[model samples]
Target: MTTIPRISLSGTNYEIGYSHGSSLKAQIARQIEFYYGMFQYSSKLDREGVHSRARDYEATILKLVPNLHQEIVGIAEGAEVDVLDIVALNVRSEIALGEFQDGCTSLSWKVTGEDGKTVQYLAQNWDWVRPVQQNLALVEIQQAEKPTIKMVTEAGIIGKIGYNSASVGVLLNALRAPPTDTTKLPVHVLLRLCLESRTAAEALSQIEKYGAASAQHILLADLSGAQCLELSPIKHHYIYPNSDNFLAHTNHPIENIAIMEPSQFPGSKERLERTYKLVETMSSKNISTKQLREMIFADGENGNFGICAPEDMCKPKWFRTMTLFNIVTCLKDGEPTAEVVFYNGSTDWIDPQNVVTL
Candidate 1:
């Protein structure tokens, strides 16, 4: 089994970034190199154009979230690399999908456990470049006035997926749509904002406020309930749980929104349907965290719709995608705990309790 490194950071935003970059500088360098190759291959763009685009994206990020920009700068300084390289990774998803086309899947639900207690569960399989798995790190960030965050992210990127001490957890899936205004917050930065939120409502408000540059789906869950938002560049659609208190989403937009376009990954529809069916079947019985983890790694008939991506299916020669990691976060006794399975083509999951707190 492969081991994912864990990093702990504290203090102001810059301080946290410096700590994060200094500790993982080598990984950051490799991550940037890998992404540059990806950009070159997928977008067919030359090096000069890629750097120019990264700088433009960096300017947008600075305009929207200046503090995040400071953090990126700190990371570049600490890692002894060009800030544009870090910025490239920060907005890689957008650049990859918009100019190139890339995408992930997530399934979440709130159900009554065997003890008859309402439990919120979220599981995600992050599909991306296989090499990126090496850059993966479990990061815990502590700030003076903001909510402490624990997230699974790439070496230089600020946030991707994770929960906070305030019992707030966020998971995301990529969506495809026509491009819109670039000034809005990118999805990854919005994810960091979600972690900063102390409650589900606050997270929703933050999403509504900044919106997104492209298309993405976010599942925001707290101890009380969970919500899924399908965000296109032009509009946002909100989906609440069904009467059974279950919600699930894949890469595609389920809601009938005008802004949503066809999913780049057609497999997303199958994944979403299979996920919903599995959750519904599991909800009929008493569910446990262990069972939840099993469901994430479940293989469908012939391994078609399984939550875990098969090695052969994850052929880097084609899509440059793989299930880099699987994350399951839950709230127990009003506290957030997370278990992560760093996909190493094996079934090894790590549970670290109390790693994130309010």
Candidate 2:
């Protein structure tokens, strides 16, 4: 029910990291500690091996995005934690899924009002360990020439989900497929790239250029339009909105037509079905922001089948899956203005105006 902390960083990437670490040292430490425990509990690998694997990821990330690498190193020096720990947090999806499984739901739509003006909206619930709530931080990054970016992320992670000054927003959901080389770009990094993009098409190109290390579903929205991207280590797919101008996706792959391997998260289909049915009931025109919030927070029968996921429903307590936060962004045309509502385990939403001017 409390407000999530916010941190602002500007200047070069290294300077940004230094500023982030200096401002949020304690929260960053807590984040690293929590992930270490979660990794140990969920995986068969020992602590030493896990740290080594993190170092391997560090190498891969640096090769993929050297700027992010410098930022992470600066953060490590300022926060006084091992650089590998930060790398582990950035790639936590890959490491955690080595043994544990989790889920998330994303939905986006365009509604036309009676006046004929259309409003674009995207909303999602980031389901993860309840304990991660303590590490949650809203980060605003300002660079020299690149687009200014804002994201809600864990303390040590560079990005998870957020929009940018270009009015481009991204929502992420985990997808399960056969594992590939851990050397490819991680999915979280791809999410960051999407935020850095100026247009939805550019974001899709970024995913195609780098390719994802694991399976993932990325929903990208901008003033122009929105698109859903399905990516695995080896293949990729694109899905457009249905006739209703509505799109909903959970953890599983639903658009795959070619013969391929089965998904590891079969339960995702049920969650997707629930979301689709709920979205179908709403009016295609004039779907207000209030209605979007209600849909994201709605619970199914006995809290069993809805967008909001409870802790008890997460099987094998060690996985720690729960709805950590819900984000709803309304993009306005002709300017970089967006109305964002960030709900952090509370009925009240954080006002974007209060946090950042953009």
Candidate 3:
């Protein structure tokens, strides 16, 4: 079975990070190299420039979530890399802004069972440059006084797409926009903060208070329902599921207020519309996790820019992006059930052995 490495971590924030770094030292180094190259190619920034931006983001992280800052410090110590390198990894989205077009399709489905129980499912197809897929790690974090978090992130990044024991799950869609706020929490850090919250409301409240550093869309869902937080440096908006009880998002900004560059990924609109149509047709029936996976894996509508992007689909092969993984979290009564399918160079293949349940 082809699978991504899964690391289980428990203890203080620093200890969790230390374990992550020590266990995945080589992967972290690879992530740094990948991002450094991406920084230069996408944002035209050198390593020194990237480090300078990372230092500014570091101050914001310290002020907002000092514990996470300590975790980052511990990661650097355990990995034997400079703290700035990890910091740069965490804030790579902010530094690059809209230059690197990493496309994704995210959705949240809320349905009520015949027994009057409500269940919410949050899922996404994480598309990115193929090389970084090797560095992906499924990290399970057990912290004191916070929800247990199971997330998939690049080796050095402290925060990313994941859910918690509190039944809150978040899916990310990177928006290609400018004007990042250095004083505010970076988008990835905000994702970690949301995972720490016990409820969706608490996550939204915390995000509003800390503010967002970049323009991105976070599709946040709980057992109750879900809301898409369309966040930018200057403004933010919340988009809930439709009357049919589901919402979908892609790389483009849904709201017109924010200034965003034209998406380099061509099929954001096509994918978003296609996802809506897929769910609408299934509204009369039960939506299973397997069904959701099928919907996410549907391809060829826009060829290379389809929902399940293929590497050869993009011209100038260096810019090719492919789905690295598809994670679906179903939040019900006792616990939230989640599964991740780590891509193995095929769009529609979902081997049972490749699925990791959390």
* Per-residue alpha-carbon lDDT of candidate 3 for residues 148-254, written as tens digits (9 for 90 to 100): 99999989888799899999889999888778899999998999999999999999998999999988899998877899999988889888888878889998888
What TM-score does candidate 3 reach? 0.95
Candidate 1, residues 99-133: lDDT per residue as tens digits?
43233667667766667877777777777656677
lDDT of each: 0.75, 0.74, 0.84
Error of 3 at 245 (Å): 0.7
Best by lDDT: 3
Off by over 4 Å in 1: 98-103, 114-116, 260-264, 300-305, 313-318, 347-358
Model 1 lowest lDDT segment of ten: 349-358
Clashes of each: 1, 0, 0
**Alpha-carbon lDDT of model 1:** 0.75
lDDT for 91 in candidate 1 is: 80
